[model samples]
Target: MNDSAIDYAAVFQALPGMVALLTPGLVIADVNEEFLRAAGRKREQVVGRLLFDVFPENPNDPAATGMRNLKASLQRVMATGERDAMALQRYDVEDPERPGHWQERYWSPCNAPVLDPGGEVVLLVHRVEEVTELIRARGGRSTGRAQGLEAELYSRARELQELNERLRRAHAREREVALALQEAMLPASRQVGNHRAAVRYRPAVGALNVCGDWYDLVDLVGGHRLGVSVGDVVGHGLAAAGVMGQLRSALSATSRVADGPAQALDVLGRYAHVVDGAESATAVTTFIDFDRHTITYSSAGHPPPVLVHPDGRVEFLDRATDPPLDARPDPIRRPEAGTAFTGGATLALYTDGLVERRREDIDTGLARLADSLRRHRAADPETLADAVLLELLPPGGATDDTALIIVRL
Candidate 1:
């Protein structure tokens, strides 16, 4: 085309949608009014400047990478005298009004080399289309070719949040219900009549709902003879709680007759084994004879009790760690007789969860609990128990129910 016949400025200014013609080095040869206004610049500011000189911060960002690739593609087109259409791309434009947020942008490039009479490249034409609205609707950056993928992602996230909230509320309600049920099953806060008694129940820390571990202190028919019991069933869900309830009821009913700890556990185990028919199931129980100052406690597969003396010296009572009842139809070899307690001391009875977790073995875990108890010897029962539960149990959940009962005699 002859220079005298061609009207270069008129043709570029007339075309729409952010047109820019560039030199080989990405220097702007010419730009349309629409392109100048959209970039928040004037014709004098952009026409002679390189593209990188305007947006220098994002050299490695995807939009910048796309621009570099377009430059390369343009070189190919210029050599072959071919026109090319680019894949869709994105850009992030800083908004002067919004300090931290950005205005997202989408673009597609049209590039061709301008040829002279010798068929040599003299300039490049870049036609850019802004598709920001379309990009925002389909979700940014990602290709959303599949139908409804964006809406599905949004809907699933919303559903997950709603489910999490419902679970939180349900857990709170379950705790309240478990606490009320446990309170009803427990003896009065203050011991009735001549018996001076205290019962402490600490639910497992991080356990979903209040566990089935509970304590009971009832005045048996024999005068001055109170029945002290700490019990835990094998599991942690509602089933375990149900089992605990049955055991407490049965123990209360039978305590009127049985005077021995071993005998009481035997009776409880016999009842549990028969619950689902056959002797396949098991539950653990411990009964203490709190005959005034003398403490004779027995266990059925439960962790040993700790004796915290008035002098702040703590010791774990030793007993034959037998299998939880239901290892056989017969009751476990009666937990060997425990240490005799003198006056002015606290005895702590707890289920295994208080001292055991999935990460560590039972022996090591129990030793840690004993050491923790001894370290906090001066702290009172409630504080000490709470600290141990918070520190020892796993952060999220408990594999078994934990029950703690502390009594000062």
Candidate 2:
């Protein structure tokens, strides 16, 4: 589990098959014990030597093409940044005891490039499997058994490819199930009295990156009062989705009877402490009183709601900010803020994913959101929500899930 403690170099030495590490310049950089044993040389002798220098073609055997073929494969990998596999071929290793004599060896070799973070080829990994015994058993490659061996090798490669494909499909199915569960938990669209209300939810852009973000448009007991909330769980996938669903449901029910946003969140905070995997989650809740022209808001370590006015003004409802749910041991009352809104104004409550970029400042994201709201202040709630998503998220997609609620006041 701790990658920092892992000895990757040791792993390379213990890996099966004869593997040699070569720099892009074709210099021998490192080789496993298996490679050294196959070459009949020590690590010291072959590590700093050139590939051709370590095991040059047999001087006595004029037909020796091992070095030539291997050189071509390694060059291809370097040039194309792709893997090159060579078929069965004879490569002779010089005999240590016999001095001048060389031992004949047949091998199936593959050369693959290792790329750096920038995607340039940095090293080449040369892997080989010795099949001298199998080749000699039939006396030559022209025999039926040799042909059968080649067929078996092809069969093994195909089996590996199929297994990888099945695993890919299984992963895709799992992602679909996670996404379905999240979709089922989310509340569908509903009208807020006498106003244009829009809710949007975007899943993170990766397999199994769905869930953990949600929004709800609840119709409170009083038909004139509408409840809107957006929240984010601590993690992704099924467990976080379950926590998100429970928290969203609890708040939706509690807000109906509670006095204001603060009181409703007070109960939800306590409920969160008992819910598994619900700690440290963040959410923002607001009650839009269509009859009163007032908005009461509360946050659990969430970003403040954005209030955009028609006259190039944006107000952040941050007075009620508090630590995330279950952030402390004892239960405490959550803070709440209230503000009056004029007609044709908009209120936006969203999860952090709407603004936060990987390397940019959070304030910058908040400012961008404000600018977008102010720029599109005249647009309807639906158009404004879509505009914010397009303006803030990257072209590829957001790495984290986002939940957004836009209420036209």
Candidate 3:
């Protein structure tokens, strides 16, 4: 093509990343050569097919979530005519030659909308860069020496992949990690005074969103007390996770120095006002003082924690709950409430995913959660955590992120 007569098709192919052009309906209009090669699919096989139809979730891996997350990102772009940058995703691709085998792949995807003159989206630019090597690099930098080491590591890993993959397929541990990609971002299980603690994190079915929900447990007063919190950042995607991470970190730092949960949250509320994307986020923080035999709690527009008695009775810590973080123009002192607990009682802190459902009242969901806790109150902390999640979550999965922490108080 001459300088004045540019070939748009050639330009699309030369865009330097794995790019796919799709209609607003998600039908693939075209794919750049890089995308076709990286995905190990011919353009003829993918173009004109729906995005999911072209690259469906790997059936062999029950933990495969690429389709759902990508679908959610694309849908968001279509809905808002905005660009969406997805977190690193582990989406396996089927081996074209092998009938049922899959090749593990990871991608950093971004979806953008191409709008018409009327400002309506006419096309969606689904761009992705294969990051399989980078993730497999496992923290290799781009320095001169690091690049060579990364290449050597990549080569060595490739040589051992067949053996490693066989071992991975034989074990369920890898699957567990894949199922909770967001879980790895959260803190691992640790001791909290004399109490036994259990934590479970499940991302939304659609977004697989690191989904703005978070949970934390911090030792206070030299192990005499424990501070725990569950919060939601009011949005989805990487942006929400960034905001959530900052708020969680701030609360973690302040909880130790603050007098109580209310003071900690008060500090966080003011901090939230300055953090981008932190507006209207909600959280519930609690301090369990062993010496006092009491639990002090404060909520910022989040669901109240549930306390299950030795028998079957449940109590909602709702007295001190207030508006969400930064909901007020100026920060005010938050309210705090405390209640004594018996020896065999249980404490539950969870994000809305455990109780909020589509087309139903929140009270109804809370009631359901309470009933489950009541029945499982006799179980131990780990057992109780698993049971509550199993019983309360929908059979398919919750559409929102869930972060649950169970403590045998």
Scored by CA lDDT, what does every candidate get? 0.62, 0.81, 0.82
lDDT of 1 at 185: 71
TM-score of 2: 0.62
Q: Please say which candidate is ahead in lDDT: 1 or 3.
A: 3
For residues 35-117, write the lDDT of model 1, one tens digit per residue. 87777667787888897565333433432444454555675565455577876655455554554555655566788878776
**What's the TM-score of each model vs. the native?**
0.56, 0.62, 0.58
* Comparison by TM-score, 1 against 3, better one: 3
Worst 10 contiguous positions by lDDT, candidate 2: 134-143
lDDT score, candidate 3? 0.82
Please give the clash total of every predicted structure, in order.
0, 0, 0
Pick by lDDT: which candidate is best? 3
Model 3 pairs in collision: none
Q: How does candidate 1 score on lDDT?
A: 0.62
lDDT of 3 by residue, 254-314 (tens): 9999999999999999999899999889999999988777999999999999988897789
How many collisions between residues are there in candidate 3? Answer: 0
Query: Model 2 over residues 348-398: C-alpha lDDT tens digits?
Result: 999998887654679988999999999998998889889999988654356
